[model samples]
Target chain A: MSRASNHQALLAFLDTIRRPDVAAIDLGEHENLVDSGLIDSLAVLQIVLFLETEFGISFAATGVDPGRLYTVSSILDLIDEFG
Target chain B: MFVNLDVGVLHEPLSGRRWEPARLRLEVERRAAHYRQQQLAPGDRVFIGYGNCLEFFADLLSVWQLGATAVPVDARLTPFEIETLVRVARPRLFLHQGELEPSLAPIFEACNVSPLDTDAVPQSEAQVPVSSFTLDDDALILFTSGTTGDPKGVVHTHRSLRARWIALQQALGLESYRRTLCLLPTHFGHGLICNCLYPWLSGQELFILPPFSPQVIMRLGALIDEHEITFMSSVPSVWRLALKTARAPQKGSLKRIACGSAPLTAHLWEQIQAWGGTSEVLNTYGITETGSWVAGTTGGPFEAEDGLIGEPWGAVVAIMKSDDTAIPPGYGEPCATGETGFVWLNTPALMKGYLNRDDLTARAVSQGWFMTGDLGYLDAQGRLHLRGRTREEINKGGMKVYPADIDAVVERFAATRDMCCFGFDDPLYGQNVGVALVLEDTSADTLRELHAWMKHHLAAHQLPVKWYLLDAIPRTSRGKINRDSVAEACAAHEPVDLANMLGAGR
Candidate 1:
């Protein structure tokens, strides 16, 4: 998958679960969903689960830094690298 | 009676500078009048919170005097959760004595409601008038354990609450205990009764800690020494941290260190006793249903055994088979004669019912007994030994598994520091065990080593199927693990591609 496709995938995945009315959830903009409260500690775990099943990928202890999962763009970059 | 809260009772007041019983009556009456002026009324639910210890206590009786229910809430809940609770309870008034206004302002806005703006400062001299309210009048609505979800409101009448208070007073001979420090939040049953009401009823002084801290506990020892302190009540976690970081209370000043809320392990209990100086570290058991602690040790302070929750105090306890029928005489849950089973509290303090949840209320209480979902067998002697929660038990390939049992063993591993063991959905077993752990060291190979270490102590089905190592586990403001969020974390699946479906953000 291309970089744009991976980014699109991440946005689509977030949309599936995120409440429709959440503001400032622009996947392309912010990199840290947690610090911004767009997503919380709970959301971070959901993102991990999403990455594993969608791409048939797994996260090892050292495979990815959690900071990489902060925003859709950073996550897309990570997914593209793995893909 | 002059109440000294810094230390447990130095002397049971045989006779001292006494406030005449008539004078105490006048004090209550005075508070009642103040609440009436504030327009508080019967059936109105008031959420009592703030950093000021005095305001939290005085406003309680004041609200009650004005015929309102004082619903104490932990100020620690996330704004979202707090907003949800406020909506559910629809408290007529919110009395907060701290700088939470900026945070609560947006929540109140979202709900399309305006909070009553009060002076940002707190008054120490606020007093209320005395009024005679029926024992059956709803006095408080404490929340249930949040292990499942945002805690539900458990309504309690004044009579029921008083019954619990009196029972605790009688059981512990609380007249003798003064000079208290409270680490528990004032919102829940245990914290409210033990720290707030108990001190008030005994006319003792209570210094409320803003939050639990190891540094604060160290200072507590010094304060006890400085003030000649006596009694303290804390949860197991607070005591554990104190043992690790601080010296015990001064030898002669402190009397008892009480631990409750979660199961107290034997090793942890002994460590607390050793470190708490001569003061006995007492294990206590109570719930919102019981109003306050119902069963505990009566001996000096420490239990003869580590994990045993003493005997049932003026409460009837039983162990039943899976069918809810009492286990036959020969084969009962292994509690001491008075101990075991779900640890039912037959006190008058059982909640009137869950607020707006008749179905849940019916399910929780039956046959004049509240069903505590805890699993334990009474010993032949009647002492209760809690194995942990029956509801929290995990099922693997038809084998029943207790997460606490496994967690206790796994936590003993040198590599593991703090852990939360729970079950997630699995196609094979319906629900398989999984664990999210914070390691003593965050190493690349830590997860691999943990998986191996768990292998020796746990069975195949009992072992954690998936391991997620965290820098820190998510905990509620009170520092208990947020199981619902953790379970949600476990159920979360990896993201699926979206390009084929909807377009990007509009």
Candidate 2:
């Protein structure tokens, strides 16, 4: 999938998981999800599950740095590299 | 007797730097001198906001060495929250490691703000004499999670801290040569007293990990192998995640593992024993008010009721009615054996009081016993079994419903990953039951099947009037699910039909 489509899919999943009224969160490509209070340690686990199921990619099989999954840009980069 | 404790840190992101304990101690002392040079006198309160790092430990020791109080805030807390706490604490010095948010700068304007760098060599010309403090001098202040209500600062004196360490030593027989692996945040009593202070006082080494995620804790096996970690303690939620993600034990170095902060289920306890490769898995019980852990199950798995918290450790446990009347100390008293009521504890390790909240302190402590606000009972064998929190208990009309009983029953469902049951305000019954579930399968058929199974297991008044399917059950930093928050969240949603969920309750 293209970068735009990937961003759209990611945003949709995040919006679903985050607080209900937080649907209009403005996304900078390189913004940190945790620092912005959009997610937390537990939410990261849910995101990993969402990535695996939605993108058909397994993070366990291909080891990824947990820190790299903390930002929007890095997560998209991970999808490009592994997907 | 002066005890020189050895401290070490496993820096996050795996910096392959070797840490010498003796060198670290000297560095900490130097930092203490630096703080003293900055006019931080004895009995002053110092607020620290650094995460789990060597600098956090150094700053803590520095404050204690000066006979000052250390108030450690959770690094994950918002700047507003931190500012609020700092205002309440009214600390003289605000020592932080990283950059403070712009919002919090105004809050620290009155206090002296100092940037703490662990790697910075301590430079001081004058010889700073260590302040002599009595055992009753206040040492540390930890804020509660504020799950049910507003967070209050729980204060502990040097004497109370030492007493807590002694109680744990008597109960667990902790000693040197046993390295401990700590993943919990040091700000909380469980992490500070039980994991760090107890081990360090016993002259054992600590392998401190950064804030835990399931991904980070999955690497526990490797750390245990490298550090030869023998003793470990964490809340029940982390253990549940570890059982799912972590690799099994590689060696028999793990000796004693304890789970506290929340009740441990029998299934999870058995899994931890099998995967941990240790026979001495203990289910502990305590709160911040009573120091760290006051009671723990040793020798084997809890063979009694699901919430059995085992015997007391160097403390006295008693059961009292709602009206503050103590149950007579006998086998067959009306409120003594096999009857649920408020759990009361009297111990030397109890907190001095809630900071600046004299009314709450007076209400919490009466005579000599600290009211735990926990609903529980003593069995015929005198072992304690926790029901639930007094505030979280569902009063359906006149009959009372305990959430722990429902949680125990619902956790048996294979599809239920995690569950929380709480009480919501209802005009009809005064209070009604609500259940929030983090399920493995969210399909309609699976939920239908689970609900059907739940109906068969729970009684009419005990059945949850509303059900919420959640991605994850919201928990505090210490892994405790705030039942009040869950109930409020359920109340926010469109009300569910109780008759439809639990057909025609009497």
Candidate 3:
């Protein structure tokens, strides 16, 4: 899939996982999900699970930087590097 | 070391504040002097507005020195929730180290409660207030749940607290806890009494930090290595993050570790053991009423098993078929060797009772055996193994939030016709709050208004993350909410998309 399609897929997954008051499409690409109250601090784990299962990004033996999953832009960067 | 009144040096790991025994005593005395200037008398209640710092401990000690009861509140509580608690707590003064919530200004005035700054100490050499508090004097009041309304503050006297400290010393020695780190909040018994106090008051160094700050949990390995921490305790939810994101501590300085305030699965238990480089990870079982840390894996060597809590510490654990508090704790058929039943604990560390709540105290305590709402069994080896909880409280990342509390607030909303709150399992928090509401209208405007009302009344953690709009809240023929059934129904349907309905899309 192209980068646009991948981004759309990421947004859809985030919609299923974020806090009830914020929409994935409304959130900025560079916005911090947790700091902006769009998602819970622990909810970042869901993002990790998503990246690992959907994009085949493995963080088992050596953990990925949590900052990579803090924002949509950073998470997309991580996906490009790993996926 | 357990009997001594002298406490160890206090350290703020983040701020780099250290107070030696002598300096700590002076600070406590200075704060006590300051409190006396404010006419803080014996038996009066003082609310602590901030926690997890050096000043908090000093203020608590000073409050005790003046024979006043110290009530520590979760700083995240909404002003409405705080007002409800303050109405019940009836504190004479509110001591804070941070900016008081501006919204609470009116409530404080109406309640006749003064907010005092912890740093506003007397300049001149004010005489230190004499420590006149008796053993029977109330020492601490931890508001466990019911913040939205019916506040249930667990009140512990100095005697009961000392009983817990002495019991911990006898059961789990103080060597491993020589340099302890507390990443949990100080408002609750598990964190204040067992994790932080049990050792620090026994003359062991304590390194305190903001509870569960991601920055700290992210670099937990380096934090431990830098402080040479020997012991620490946290919930499985926190370990979940550290095990995935943070590097494991390489130093062999850690002697013991504990996971409590929530269930510890064998999977997470092993991961915690590996991450901390310690095999002594204990799955501790405790409740707010029992001064916390009543039982745990303390006795002998054992493999990590799911729901396996080894033995009682400073308490007698009993499993009985009858849960009736009116009957004597022993006046029932004991559960056969491995049969799960109501867990009862007879311990000297039990709280005096809920603050100003004799009815609640009566229901929980009978003949010195406090009924733990947990369903656990005593194995053939006489170890305590937990099964589940019977209470209608949601354990969100180890912070217990009651369903009734949320329901109380939602039911009061003008648009809400009926409401029921329940716990749903989550990958992050072991369980998160979810609600089923029967509103007058299903319009987006009504939901938005209800959302604003909920945000004003409820704490951030107490807000329902998953919402379900229903025609009616399911009830049994007896006219009572069966939360389990309602939650199961919610699971069969997708939760309402508040963001999409409210047009938050670009």
Identify the leading candidate in terms of TM-score. Answer: 3
| 10 residues in a row with least lDDT, candidate 2 chain B | B497-506
Q: Write the per-residue lDDT of candidate 3 for residues B402-456, one digit (tens) a residue.
A: 8889999999999989989999998777799999999999788888888889999
Instruction: State which candidate has the highest lDDT.
Output: 3
Per-residue alpha-carbon lDDT of model 2 for B148-222, expressed as tens digits?
Answer: 124478999988888888888877886432688778778878888888778765666676777555556666666
Cα shift from native, residue B49, model 1 (Å)? 3.5
DockQ of each: 0.02, 0.09, 0.38
Q: How many angstroms is residue B149 displaced in model 3 relative to the true structure, after the best TM-score fit? A: 1.8
Better of 1 and 2 by lDDT: 2
Residue B478, model 2, lDDT:
92
Query: What TM-score describes the B chain of model 2?
Result: 0.74
Answer with 1 or 2, whichever has the higher TM-score: 2
Error of 2 at B303 (Å): 3.1
Reference-based TM-score, model 3: 0.94
**Which regions of candidate 1 are displaced past 4 Å?**
A1-83, B1-35, B98-132, B145-151, B299-303, B323-340, B393-506
